[model samples]
Target chain A: MKNGAVLTVNDLRVYYDTPAGTVKAVDGVSFDLRPGERLGLVGESGSGKSTMALALMRMHKPPARIAGGEVLLDGVGDVMELDDEGLRRIRLDRLALVPQGAMNSLNPVMRVRDQLADGIRTHEPGDDRDALTARIRAQLARVGLDADVGGKFPHELSGGMKQRVAIAIGTSLSPSVIIADEPTSALDVVVQRQVMETLRSVQEEIGASVLIVGHDMGLMAQIADRMGVMYAGKLVELAPVHDLFTNPQHPYTRLLIESVPTLMAKRALASIPGAPPTLINVPPGCPFHPRCPSAFEPCDSEVPLPTSQNGRVVSCHLYPGEAA
Target chain B: MTAFLEMTNVSKVFSAGIIRRQHTVAVDDVTMTIDEQSPSILAVAGESGSGKTTLARLLLGVIPPSSGEVIYRGQSVDDLSREQRRTYLREIQPIFQDPFESYNPFYKVDHVLTVPAQKFQLAATKQETTRLIHEALDMVGLQPAETLGRFPHQLSGGQRQRVMVARAMLLRPRLIVADEPVSMVDASLRATILESIRRMKQELGISVVYITHDLTTAYQIADNILVMYKGSVVEAGSVEQVIRDPKHPYTQLLVSSIPQPDPSLPWGAEGEIAGDPESMEVAAVGCKFVDRCPVAFAPCAGQRPPLYHEHPSRAAACFRYDDAPTLEGENLDLVFERQLASQPASGSEEQAAN
Candidate 1:
């Protein structure tokens, strides 16, 4: 909604040093998360949406390395340049992650209260034990969980309950940016909406900018103000959710929007023709050219850079411009 | 004799924690039936502990019913003979939720299709076997060349799930039980898998028992739907009838909770997973959903409600349907309409929570 960038990735590249080949997982991906805005990174499986999220948080582990580009918070202090201590300091305060499969991430042996307290203690050691427990209970209550829930173990909690707990922990520090990777994919629709609502409420309470990664464009449209369409490790389109669905600029973006199953029994849920390309051996030019129906000569010969058009940053030969 | 498959007052009880006497009534007395000649999709939709999975297990004959019976054709599953059991295996097939776990990672994907054919004696010659495998794979939108020799890891989530469908097709089963088949697959890829399941009915004349918690997908694919809460079937009807105009409060809550792709229609606050776990244990009698149901009255706590027939094609277990006929539709509509009316265009109450 505003020009202030809570988090910005400038031509970020994360590659997997595999035995087969150097797999470009996040190939020159760039996007900005504005304050109080929810941005969704929508893509298919193996499309590197998750990889881009990990790179943003500097969680891209071994076998995968950040090859180039910068990750800046508020257009200052490159996240890539930070040391382990500085990275830890930057995390949970400025940048927080609600990890994938978050329900299973909690320690089953420990009580939910202890786990929440553990996270709070690691970040804010100045707070006393009682204050931390009170804060934990308060956070749990905010997500619709009972105060008694803090006393129980993770194993005792349901999938939805655990997910809410994860959100509570992720936003406990009131971080400026919250990156949730496939947060609601594991829960049912009833629980899914509940989790989404909880995430939204928590984000709103903290006024945090959220970046959610998911494969469902329709689900993303519900929470995200703007969505980035990632395909085979490249962001082909970035636009408002309504605009992305209605007036899609990129070919890959068009195909994805057309695939959603709306309530009205919208017909012709077209498949994307081919399987997602492997990062190990990506296509020569545009990684989506193999599946793109409107693929032309330039699509095969040269990779299209991010060109701004109609308030969207689209990377395609079709939308050729650099104006913002 | 008209009953192809019938579940009469079926129930399942499992012991909880370390106490043998402390039992959890997983699936309560639920009665449902599939007509003989009319083979169509019967979807069992529910939340996590709603017994949908339990019903699928009971249907597959993997677990015996603690009470009542599952009647197949004219015979009860508990009374099946040795020969009947063999025939039953071919008559009904199961498609599990996770694709990767369904098959052996060590074996080639083709083994799943070919082994069933060899065991069932569906094909004799090598050429015939090849043709059958190719056809089955092709039916699910996978090519034999690209998919056959590969391991489960080699394929995508959609591809692996389709292989499972192809394996089921090899048996040429009369019925298929797909339990949350697309829950693990990507959303866009769901259309392909669902289309494959739909094609089986038209091409092979096989009825599908689709068990899932996703209402949107159910609306898209299901012919009939049974919505369960805790362990009780709260609503059952034709897909359009139940989703479009729900009779039960639980169904209404479910229909309302669905994140409409349209940003303009914001969600209601009442049904954001606010149920108390202790509510299920408070009583042995009455509605399973009484605690969580927004419109629940005094009778909801005292006695269990019967499935009141709303439309000719639909039935719901809410006392409000017939008991409280005085509450006009317009009033209830106003109550629900107010939630939608109050909803902001884009941002939810979460925005206001700030």
Candidate 2:
């Protein structure tokens, strides 16, 4: 909290209480979010990136339960310890989440302006209505939306615009930390850039730490200050953006980097051989062991301890005997 | 010197809305050739509604072009008879963008692989179908037994995409129309899907028409590149020439628009303002990219540029390179001034309307 780390999650585990069995969606994940910093949480589907993001906001439904660990917000106590009312206050005023498929996140029946006003009214009851309207308009403009767009219905705006509006509404409360889950996945290249730029600008304007959960490494590299590479249900590598891309230590991280098609590089990309393990029945050893090219005997039997290498923490057997 | 597939002035128009009054031009006057012996991957690179998907659909003969024709093996795709169409389908196949949507979520992953074998009668028995499915799965780096029983939802995006590729390969098609095939897969798994297709081209001598907006992947896999902007081929050439040494203003803009993985480079310095979405629906004259084109000249407003041959392998539809008489120096500047004046005062309004 002293270092502008707005949110600190340690050994956080979230599992789905499904009828079949408990699905370990997120397991033993630890990370810190510095104020105004952008952290890109990257992994394929079922790697538990989305689940972890949802768990941070404490927004999971009945079937999903936070199994263990702590999520600390600056100036606020443990998130899990908070009662329903305490969580509600934190949700609207301190933490905002831009969920996945934001195209549908908006209230389809409500006008865009009314939606923003509704959020403001619900969160800040005593705030002046005129002031709220003006603020919403300004926020919309900040995200590159027209002031008139507030009057239009959700279906009236394009996918990119709808997403921008969602961002505008999400940041209206001026939260300390914002979690955006795959915000630009459905957007085309040009629109994708615009949406990403909006997110970057919004974060800058509000000075909020942004956690972007996505699978696009190239896009993540463009915006993220630091990145945490998740595989299966575990965090494999966490490093500064440049270090993660250029000098990855984890076998899984290397595979991720190598798999990205770069403009300058011409070598045949080596796609990691196997699929991500099922979260319900994860492999016993390193979650990524089945797909790791350099995996050996210990990799399949014992979970690799997280070790620090060149300013980055990588959980891999490759970085054995290093400082944890 | 016969081309494997040649698209001559192909255009596709779709009617939208309840009354079906709106005409959406998906592919517009796009003409290119894929040579038989060249063994090169042709990238049809553009964003959604840039007509890349329509062009892919046209090539696959899944949908007939509204105008013009696609020639396959020196025969027109539109004119193919029943048996000929079947042969054409055998020669050309498609790899869809969303692997999850490509298969029935309820069915097992191997079901997609076995369908083509059964359709083409490549496997007369269950055992042969099983064997072929295993071989195809192995080629895509999947263990047959492991993938055989898994549902689409159970597998990751990467695995499902590979299964789609394997299904395409089962037909042993000479050409593949991959429409943003890896866009949905994870960045870590994209190279694998791309490599599988590249391997198909190399090992089986299949030509690939890769449609994508990602220049990075296009640079890696495409031997030749075609940059489409608003239903037109703005530039077409060898991948190195088009990507490294682009000629058209549109092509240059697109190549530069790609954010490099390097963090040192400041973001948005090379960024192009998003195009007016309404412009796609308009019946544009001159150049479709005139509004966004930095180097657009006067002739770019009044008259459309033809695809001018620069080198034997390269062609571009830009007044700067074309031999059109109206494209003189001062005139270009005058045209640029007029266009700037004619553009809507509020750029954001254009986006809002869309």
Candidate 3:
């Protein structure tokens, strides 16, 4: 792992083996997660944002496999090289995942308290029932739920409540890195705001680095300190949230930022001219060049590596510099 | 002037539970209208379970209202004769949220367009039908050559939705009831879909009732806005008035909750938290939003607040607007007329000439 980073991903590539060919879902993505920092990954449906989140926690199922990458954790060794027992040992205690679809994440038959206790018991089996109960109450309280909520089943909770319970379970052991995949996708804006608030507060209390993955740029701008834009399975631009919104560098990033409608102003939304290329067989050179407005000669023939200058990293021919 | 379509005191109640038969008011007493002479977009903005879909169903005559009438050209929809009903279906089209579900996987994409043309007898022969299909597809900005021979699964979500827009355009409907058209689409593609819908108003001079939970898109494209909450119209006015300066407490909560793309202006500190979803059971006697409303007072708990006409062009169903006169039967139409008149023309007249 890097000196001060909590998690360092190097050349991470996750691919799905289909009948036709290998679908490169997460292609050559690299980034570092600072402790207590919130980094958000924004992308469209087929952009591989969710796939990267699952692959980071090594939770991707069959057909989807991590091709080659180094997911190095602080104190812990390389996550990609970890065996079954080693991966299981470090999963919830050192790293956790709050998956998508909170409505279906929890067990329907189990009580909220029991679902929480399962994670705790798996890690620390020696804890007594009273201690577990106390810990469960504290976890529920931290997520702004009442102690009585522990006895209720998953079906009894609302969409926002289910998400809160999911967060409580994820942060129960105080993991160093927490990956939240579209934690507020199905929620209404009002409930979304409340749930995000709860997630942020709980993350702060635990001092865990959050890697939130979603498509909503507005929601990402609110919660994420640093933002990464993904297109065609590649991390095209990574910059601080403010700079990314204010002065987006990559053409795709700029188009995405301009596409979002705002309440304060009304302007013609800049729709990207073309759709994202299929990842099954990505076009050579830059994947975003086809849709990019300022497509030069090099953009069609040569891939622009991530160029870092002034704490901003953008992959585009317009910014010529040493690759990060 | 006669309205193109109007819902007068419309309310729909669904009785669930076979044994107990609990009646859920899916859509409460609400009245809105679209003028035939002036083509515009009316965005019905609200959260889930806010009766946005039920309202769309009511507009499209997919479901019958329990109390009031859906009047089309001064005639009740329920009392329309067979020929009039057929004409009504041909004139008022619907664009649903999920484009994938709307298509049959077994048939080619052309099947969606061709079947409607045959049903409505839009063209006399197959050659004329194909020509009409090509023209419709071109209207929505899809290349007919690329989209015609493909199945629903072959096209991208954005393309499928545009095809659906093209399908809606084939009949040349006077009003298009688009229920959350872009909710299931990708963020990058949302603008294109919305742009096509806007073009329906501009190029074709068709009025649209765009139902969605997204306020930003509503603000971007809609001329007038109706903010729904718990099956009731909490606020209704020009999009500029309702979104920029919300009157109802629930509308304020909704507006504030929307996270702007700009990071400099972060969301404000959490105010009064919304009540839990289980506590969202509607009260039959009082304001539906009273339980979650931050400014709820004594009057809010007594009787349902009427749509108080706060301005010539705006109305909100809240006690905060108690100083304004309560809108009676014909006042809603008057206020809506003013609302439409206040906005600049959306270029529909010039484009309609083309």
Candidate number of the best TM-score: 3
> Could you say which candidate leads in DockQ?
3
DockQ by candidate, in order: 0.39, 0.55, 0.76
Error of 1 at A247 (Å): 1.9
How much RMSD separates candidate 3 from the native structure? 2.4
In terms of TM-score, how similar is model 1 to the real structure?
A: 0.91
Error of 1 at B81 (Å): 1.8
Q: What is the C-alpha lDDT of each candidate?
A: 0.80, 0.79, 0.88
TM-score sort, best first = 3, 1, 2
lDDT of 1 by residue, A1-324 (tens): 236788778889999998888988889988888889999998888888898898887898888899999988873479999999989987877788998776578998999888888878888898877788789889898888999999999878888888888998888889999999999887767677778888998899989999999886657878899999888888888998888777888987777767667666636456677778878878888888888888888999798888886678998888779833
Residues A21-48, candidate 3: write the lDDT tens digits.
Answer: 9999999999999999999999999999
DockQ of 3: 0.76
* CAPRI quality level assigned to candidate 3 from its DockQ score: medium
Model 1 docking category? acceptable
Badly placed stretches (over 4 Å) of model 1 are A1-3, A266-268, B17-20, B269-274, B277-282, B323-354
Relative to the unseen true structure, what is the C-alpha lDDT of residue B276 in candidate 1, on a scale of 0 to 100? Answer: 54
Model 1 chain B: weakest 10-residue lDDT segment is B330-339
